[model samples]
Structures are given as structure tokens and as C-alpha cells.
Target: MHVTFPGRHGADPARAVDGVDLDIRPGEIVALVGESGCGKTTLARSLLGLVPPTAGRVTFGGKPLGYSSRALKAYRKRVQLVLQDPSGSLNPRHTVYDAVAEGLRIHGYGGDEQEAVAQALSRAGLRPPERFFLRYPHELSGGQRQRVVIAGALVLEPELIVADEPVASLDASVRGEILALLLRLRAELGLSALVVTHDLGLAWNIADRVAVMYLGRIVETGEVERVLTAPQHPYTRALLSVLPEAPGDPVVLTGEPPDPSRIPSGCRFHARCQILASGEAERAGVADACRGEDLPLLDGGGRAQVACHWARAVRT
Candidate 1:
């Protein structure tokens, strides 16, 4: 998928998701990681036809798909989304069984409702399926409710599932169980998943590959082991620095990112980048030499793609 913004404006008048190019292969788990507002969710939404790119194209099964009514409906059936909040995603009035069965009905699956619900419940770890069938969203605990949401998407048997921070709201103890269930579902169904999250550790645990985004574009993408262990982009380095480490770890970056609306010019991350532009006063200080340069997203060693002119220097 190639996504671009032609003078796009976000909630803050800056293009939240700038030009982004990515692909999710079947049976592969791709993790999109970044700070909030980096367009991780927006990229996911664009795939689902929720966010229309101003100047780009999305191809599924080697065919182009715009955000048209028919194409979107078809895309939706093959690509399901599991939201972050089960409470918000599920209809409060509907029972667990109803929520799970909704997808089957919409897709015109005229099979046994009872059997499908049981299977979905089992897959989502809500075993002893009878217990959850009659409960409403409000009646179930946070974890259980999230399971219900998963069951709804899994029941459809989609080729791809976009989980947008599916466990962000759950308790830490229950978070593991949910992640386990997701892995189990992928294994059993051979389904591909795009997990959107800011937690690099979580991505390390689950994703086959990782794509690091910043200021609406993917700055670094490669095999999970390569990118996380030895990040090419300076932005990726800063993100890794803040992660929990062993005792006596050194402090990393200094401050927060620049404002998105008034984004730093040339390289979006040059303002916060420590290695990319150290000597150039205009690039280093607030004078803004880095503001005018546009760096292409280039391929680097180890099959990793990076978007920084100084990537070679940083990598070496």
C-alpha cells in the first residue's frame, strides 16, 4: 500500500499521516510502532478504507481498491478490525452471542449460529462458551469483553486483522492472556495481522517484522530482530532508548518531539535527531537548515528500509 497526503491537514493543521508505503503479506504479522499521532492508527484505518488518502493507492490481492462503497464492503469482509476498547466497540445492548454472530449474519453465512458462536468463544479463550453467550458487554470484565470483541472479528475468518492497541486498556496480568489468544488464532487460522502499538517490547514479542513511523511516515522498517536490536533511523533509536531496561541504563534523548503542525522542515526528525545533523548550525540549532531538505526513504543494509540521509553514519 502506498499512501500520501497532498497538502493534507490533520486535527492540528499538519498532515498526521504523511506519505507512507507498506505491505502486509499473508500469514505474516507486521507491527506498526510509534508515538501517538504518528499515524499508526491512520495507516491501519486507510487499509480498512476508513481514512482516504489524498494522493495514493491501496492494492489488495493485486487489485486497486478505493474507498468506494462496493470496494469498501468487500475489503471489510476480508479485512476485519479489532478496536482498542471492547466497551466502545461492542454494542452494550447486544449479548456476547449477538456480537459474535453479527459478522456471520452480515457476510451472509447461513450456517449454524450456535456452532459458530461456540467456536468463536473457544478461539477467544472464552471457553465454557455457554457462560458468555448470554452476558452483555457491561456485565463482563474488561479482559472478557475484549475477548468478545476478538471473537466477533475471528468469527468472520478474515484474511487480515488490524488490531489497533487491542490490549492497551486491559490490566497487565490479563494482557498476556489476550496476546496469547491472538497468537493462537493466527496459528489456527493462518491469518495475517497488523498490530498497531507504541510498545516496542510488545512488538518484539509478537511481530515478524516491525515498521517504525514518525511524523506520519515510516522511518525504519525491517525484520523485527534487526530493527529493534540495531535501529537505523535516529528516531527509532530515541524510541528504543525510552524502553524499560536493565539496572544502570544510560539516559537517552533529551526532550519530547516537535509540534506536528509546525513540523521541522527537511527531515521531520532532524530537530530531535542527535546523530543526523550535529555540526550544521542551521540543522542543529533552531535556525532551521534541516527544514528545507527532503530525504528519500532509502533501502539500507540487512533488507531494512530507512528514511534518513545520515542513516549510513548512524548504522556504522
Candidate 2:
């Protein structure tokens, strides 16, 4: 999907998605990673036709999307979203069974509602279905509530799922459970997923592909193994360095990423990048250089597309 700004409305005009294009194939999970305010959520929303793009189009199976009433209903059925907060999505008065069955009711699925709700709950890892059917949003714990949200999405039998920080608020112990559920769902249902998250760990654990965004622009994207092992963009490397690591192969990235609204000219990451230091290297460091030029997507092997002029050297 491509998104641009004519001018700033709620989002900063200077900070806008430019030529943002990526796709998830069937049964694959693509993780979107960036700092807060990098427009990860905006790009995700654009895929489902929730956010209208000012410059480009989004197509699924080669058909451009139209946000009209009919198109929206079709898109809603094909794509589902799971928000970070369970309480925000679930009604306090509705029981778990009602919440899970709500989609079937809306879509007019002529089947046993109870059986459908039971299957959704089972798919979401809420075992002994009866345990959760009667519970309210407030009655369930954070993990269970998040599972309910997942079950709600599953009940619709969507082809694609957009998960925005699915386990962010859950306790550390419970986080693994939620992640496992999502992985299991992807395997069992053959669903494509675009999960938006700020946590690099989450990406490493669950993503088949990774997209790194900075200042509302996608600076790097590649297979998870390649990008995580050898990042191309300075912004991506910086984010990775700060994350916790094992002792043997410690990699520390330097400097903070630039702010979105006040982005730097040429490359937004030049301001805080250690790779661009003048005295340290006549040319740019491993992944530096091209400061005054715009880097388009470049092939970096294994169906990986990265956007850094010096990414080749970085990968080596």
C-alpha cells in the first residue's frame, strides 16, 4: 500500500508514508517494526481500506480496493483486525460467547451459533470452551481477554489478520501463550498476518518477514533472518542494538532515530547514525553513505528487499 499526505490533518504533513509497498502471502506472517509514531498502524489500516491513501492504491489478489459499502463489507469479511487492548474491543456487558458469535451474526452465517463459538474459542486456545463462554470482558484475565479478541477475529474466518501488538499488555508469562496461539492459528487456518509491533523480540519470534519503518517511511524490509542478522538501514540497526541479546554475539547499535515531523533531508536517519560519521570512515560505514540520495528498494537475496545504498557491504 502507498500513502502520502496532501497536507497535515491529524498526522503531520511532513511525516507521511511514501511508496510503502509490501505484501503477505498465504500462511506467512510479516512483522512491521518501528518506534512509536512511525505510521506502522496507519499502513496496516490502509491495507484493510480503513485508512484512505492520498497517492496510491492497495490491491488484494490483483484487485484494487474500493471503500464503498459493498467493497467494505467484502473486505471486512476477508480481513480481520485484533487490537492491542481487549477491553477496548470487547463490550463489558457481552459474554465471551456473544462476543465470539457477533461476527457470524453480522455476516448472516446460517449455522449453529453455539458450535461456531465453541470452535472459535478452541482455536484461540481458550480450552474447555464452557469455561469462557459465559465470562464477561472484565471477568477474564488479560491473556484470556486477548484470546477472546483473537477468537472474535477467527469466528469470521478471515483470510488475513492484522494484529496490532496482540500481547503488549499481558503479563510476561502469558505473552508466550498468546504468541503461540497466533502461530498455531496461522498454521491451522492458512492465514496471512501483518502484525504491527514495536518489540523486536516479537518479530524475531514470530515473523517470516520484517519491515522496518522510520519517520513514516519504510527504510528496510527482508526475510527475518537476514534483516535481524545483518540490518541494512541505520535506523533498523539502531533499534536492534538496544534490544536484549545473548552474550556470545552482542551487537550494539548507536544513537536515537530522528523524529517524524522534523525529518532530515535526503535520509531521515543521518542525524543519529554512527555509520555516517565523517572522521571514522572516508566512505560510509557498513550500512552508511547515500546521505544525500534517496534509496529505493534493492534486492538483497532470498526475496529480501532493503532500502540502503550501502546495504550490500553491510550484509557482507
Candidate 3:
């Protein structure tokens, strides 16, 4: 899907999601990585039809997404969303059963609602699902509540799920359990997921592919190991350099990312890119190109696609 959102105001960023093209193959998990405000969530919401794109198109199952109520309802059944915060997402008054059964009710599930709800909860790992049926959101632990949220999405038996920072709010240990649950569910159900997160470690833990977003566009994309271990874009490299287990001296980005409203000309990352400022590109005789021309993500015909002049030159 390709998605873009119009600027909030004349002076605000023109597009929250700017000409980003991303694909999630069947049963594949793709992690969308970026700093806060890089439009990761915007792109994810577009897929769910929550955020309407001002430009570009979103197609699922070879069909363009439709905005009509009937169309959206059907689309939602095939593509569910697991939001970042369960507390904010689930209603305090709703019991665990109600939470999971709500989707079934909305979709007019006429057969055995109890059995369907129980199965969804069980699949999400809320063991002895009957035991939690009457429990409200407050009664469950953070992990359990998140499981309930996942259970809600599962009730519809969606083919694809858009998980926006699914584990960001959980404790470190619980984070692993949730991620493991996602993996287990995918393996068993053949579910494709688009995980939006700022946590690169999460990508390393669960995603098959990683797409690094900067400002509003994808700066790099590739297999999980290749993108995390050998990032091609300067922005991606800087993000990895700060990982606790990263080897060698860290590549510290010197300044905050540019304001989306006032994005720099040419390469959006040039102002903060260490490679562009390091004089290596000058020695390689590509400094002018880095500063004078915008670069698109070039497929390296390997495991990665990168959008930086210096990286492309070196790879070629």
C-alpha cells in the first residue's frame, strides 16, 4: 500500500505519510521502524481505514480499499488492528468476554458466540478462557489486558493484523511473552502482520523484514538481520549504533531530525547524516549529488533496498 496524509495546516508537514510504498507478503511479518512522529502509526492506520490517505492508494487482496460503510466493514474483518495501549483501547466496563465477543457481535456472528469468544481468548493465551470471561479490564494484568486486545482482533479471524507498538507499554519481561504470542499465532494461523514500532530490538525479535522510516519516507528496507546488522542508509545506521549490543563506536546523530514542515531540499536526511558530513562522500566525489539531488530507494539486488547516494555508490 502507498499512503500519504495532507498537512495539518499550511505551515505543518505536508504529508504525514509521504509516498511510502510497502508490501507485506502473505504470512510475512514486516516491521515499520522510525523515531516518534515519523508517520509509522499514520501508515498503519491507513491500512485499517482509520486514517484516510490524502494521496496514493491502498489495495488489499488485489482490490482498492473502499470508504463506504459496507466496504469498510468487510475490509476491517479481513484486516484487524492491535493498538499500542490496551488500557486506552479497551472499555473499562467491558468484561474480557465482551471485549472479544464485541467483534463477533459487530460482524453478526450467528453461531455459538460463547464458543467463538472462548476460542479467541484461548488462542491469545488467556488460559482457562472461561475463568476470565467476567473479569473487567482493571482486573487483568498489563500482559493479560494486552492479550485481551489481541483476542478481540482474533475473534474476526482476520488474515492480516496491523500491530502499532504492540508491546511498547508493557514491562520488559512481558514484552517477550507478547511477541512470542504473536509469533505463535502467526505460525499457527498463517497471519500476516505489519508491526509499527520505534523499538529496533522488537524488529530483531519478531519481524522477517524491516523498513526504516525517516521524516515520512522509507529510508531503508531489507531482511531483518541485514537491515539491523548492516544498515545501508545513514539514518538507519545511526538508529542501530545506539543499540546496547551494537559493536564498535556508535554513530551519534548530531541534531534532531528536521521538522517535517520545513524538510530540507535534496536528501531529507543530509543535514543530520554523518556520511554526508564525514568527507567520505567528498573523497568518493559524490558530495554534490548528496546535497543537490533527492535519492530514491534503489534495489541492490541483494537483501536490501536503500535510499542514500553514498550507500548506493559504495554498494555498486
Leading candidate by lDDT: 3
Estimate candidate 2's alpha-carbon lDDT, on a 0 to 1 scale: 0.80
lDDT of each: 0.81, 0.80, 0.88
* Colliding residue pairs in candidate 2: none
| Cα-based TM-score, every candidate | 0.88, 0.89, 0.95
Q: After superposition, how far is residue 147 of candidate 3 from its true place, in Å?
A: 0.3
Error of 2 at 155 (Å): 0.2
| Stretches of model 3 off by over 4 angstroms after superposition | 1-9, 297-303
Over 1-316, each residue of candidate 2 has an lDDT whose tens digit, in order, gives 4565544576556445656777778788999999887889888888878888877788887788888988988889889999999989999999999999999988888988899899999999899998888889998899989999999999988999999988888899999988888898888899999999999889999999998887677788888988899776666776787776833334443455565556666566666656665433235353335556666643322376666555555456
Tens-digit lDDT track for model 1 on 281-313?
333343343456776753322267887766643
lDDT of 1 at 222: 92
Better of 2 and 3 by TM-score: 3
Cα-lDDT of candidate 1: 0.81
Steric clash pairs (candidate 1): 265-291, 266-291, 282-289
Best by TM-score: 3
Sequence-dependent TM-score of model 2 = 0.89
Q: Per-residue lDDT for 267-306 in model 3, tens only?
A: 8888888987889888777788888898764332235788
True-structure Cα RMSD, model 3: 1.9
Instruction: By TM-score, rank the candidates, best first.
Output: 3, 2, 1
